[model samples]
Target: MNHAWIDGRPGSEPEAVAAAAALIGGSRLPVVTGLATDIAGIRAALGLARIAGAVIDHQASAAIYPAVTAIRDSGMMIGAPAEIRRRADRVLIVGDAFATSPDLPDFLFRHEPDLGKATRGKREIRWLGGPESSADIPGAIEPVVCPADGIADALAMIRAAAAGHRFGEGPIAGEQAEAVAAWMKEAGFGCAIFAVAGMDELAIEMLAGLVFDLNAETRFTSLPLFGPGQAFGAALAATWTTGFPLRVGFGRGFADHDPDLHEAGQLIASGEADLAIHVSGLAGAASPEPEWSGRLPVIAIGGGAASWANPPKIRFDAAMAGRDHDGVLHNERFGSFVPFAATQTGTLPRAADLLAAIAAALGDVTTGAAA
Candidate 1:
């Protein structure tokens, strides 16, 4: 198969798709096609979802519907970082606790403590430990004794406290859980931010089953500090344009979305997305399939001459995300916007911008929210 590769930079989805489509017509990775909304990386992945019979997955998975359902079914609360930094005295960071970078504790105590904002005052800070005690809280500060494993017990206790009740069983029950519950009840204003950790293993639907249960009784909110650069931006853009996130299929001449039924990974893995219109930047997350189905045809559009055994021959070229054009990225520490500084390593294509070009090439690819 002659592969037509498109350089899928961070902001060039439309261009990448159009380029690949001009050659191969459609793709098979339904999940990759699903990101074709107005945002996420370059955001047109949603447009190609059904055409390729691929599942449109967010960087995580295609089951973003459950996340939406969770939000709608169980109302949530929110406080921006600006608010948390200026006003939140006690910050609770939990889930998949890994490395305790030096700057984290420093940010809570040193920087956030003295914000210039007058209305939102600052106060004492505490680091709620994750499974691993990565954050080096000083001896003086008491790290919330997050059990090595029993997060559910702690969560149930918190739930009980939030609901004006108490459960005496479980590891986090009794005094400890009560103490957290009391804190929740008393805090003038508090924020709880959730990430992919709570249930990255399960689909967003199943994950929501647990999360909604938490939101049922609490004033706390859950926000995914996302993975993949511009991930939130992508989700926001996609939903705005199409009313949904990843796993939009565009194969049947229009768009169709279903998280469980159409994940790109599953599609390609299952040999469904026979012709892959892959738009990737070196930095962003791509599918981690151990091998591409032997029959799969990949029109890989990107900015590298990288080779892989899975596809045997992947047509590729140079592309840009943070390079070539000034782009937008959020810092790792906090989701602070960082302006990209483009260097004229001036290689090949910009993935998102390329996708925009592809849209133009394909001509009149509708938003097709109705489809």
Candidate 2:
């Protein structure tokens, strides 16, 4: 299963790796992105980025930015899923809570209550936006139909009410706001949940602020829902390895992080990167390559070959982490690394193996040039 391609034509893996290595090694600036792999694969990609003096980012970083930025600006009181299921008697969800994770209802109703140690009373569920669904959520007293676009204003009103501050009317009525504020204050443990995929930065910030404010009087935490992708794992790997998160560059003989300037989309669109390496090893169809990616040569490695409109210079069908190969991935629910055993013994090479090969070839090119 050494299926590889170069310039839209069938080629050997060695040839493809050699061509990709040459393209990356000769470039003054290279960018590595499409980081949908597990921790092992991301670590290999980061190593290559460091050696190639490239900038690194993830395809889903844009969707993740709001929550990450919110956490960075105002520290978040994060909670685990298990803890929320066991302890959170009240859950305040904003914007289509079940849209991203369909199994959320199951977790909330069937799974959470089955916990033998969870002696808490029935949980209360509330929603802010999104169309109503037929799925029966336990203890759903009433659904608040707040506009999706007006979540920030709604959260601000809630925060102000929680803090006992006088603010003019906004989305939610003053009485409703006061009631919600009082519920949060009285709840033994409350969890504020929001899906970042559908949320704006201001909304996330407002939610975080509300949690922070509520913690003043009672125990409250946030459960920011992220879509199914190992983007969190990628970010965590980058942070632990480089002392910085994604959108980091290593061109100046050291890792430098710039969330705005060095973002993969901006760098590629601005013609700052001469070459790009797109890596994705997780399951599911890959997203289309950025439009600006056509400005430079691209080497793609992963399962997302179907998503690319324009063929890359070199492409390799790599094994999916945790499915075709063993790897470690961050479990956000429990905030731990879960060891995933290989489910299939496929011939497809692991992403780490492919990237390591490219890195070796790149090193040879560098060494030869220096000699």
RMSD of 2: 2.3
Q: Model 2, 1-371: lDDT tens per residue?
A: 45799888889989988998999988988999988888888999999999899999988899888877777677778887887877777788788766767776566555444333234666776676656763556555556667778788888888888889998878778888888888877767888887888888899988888888888877888888777677767877888898877888999989998889789888888877788899878865455666665688889898766457777888999988768888888765555678888887888888899999999999999999999
* Every model's TM-score: 0.71, 0.92
Error of 1 at 58 (Å): 3.6
**Model 1 stretches with alpha carbons more than 4 Å out:** 1-19, 26-41, 47-55, 62-69, 72-75, 97-105, 112-129, 135-141, 198-223, 251-255, 282-295, 303-305, 311-314, 330-339, 343-347, 360-371
Clashes of each: 67, 0
Q: After superposing candidate 2 on the true structure, give the runs of residues whose Cα lies further than 4 Å from its correct spot.
A: 111-120, 134-136, 285-290, 332-335
What lDDT tens digits, residue by residue, belong to model 1 across residues 1-371? Answer: 22243332332434444555454443323335323212334454544443333445554443234444445455345455555555554445545432323344454445444433323544433334354454454323445666535555566666666566746776553776667656654444445544543433333333233334444444333334444434455555555666765455655655565656656566667665665555555343443432443456555445333445454233444345555556665554565555676665664555555555554554433333225
lDDT (0-100) at residue 13 of candidate 1?
39
Clashes of 1: 67
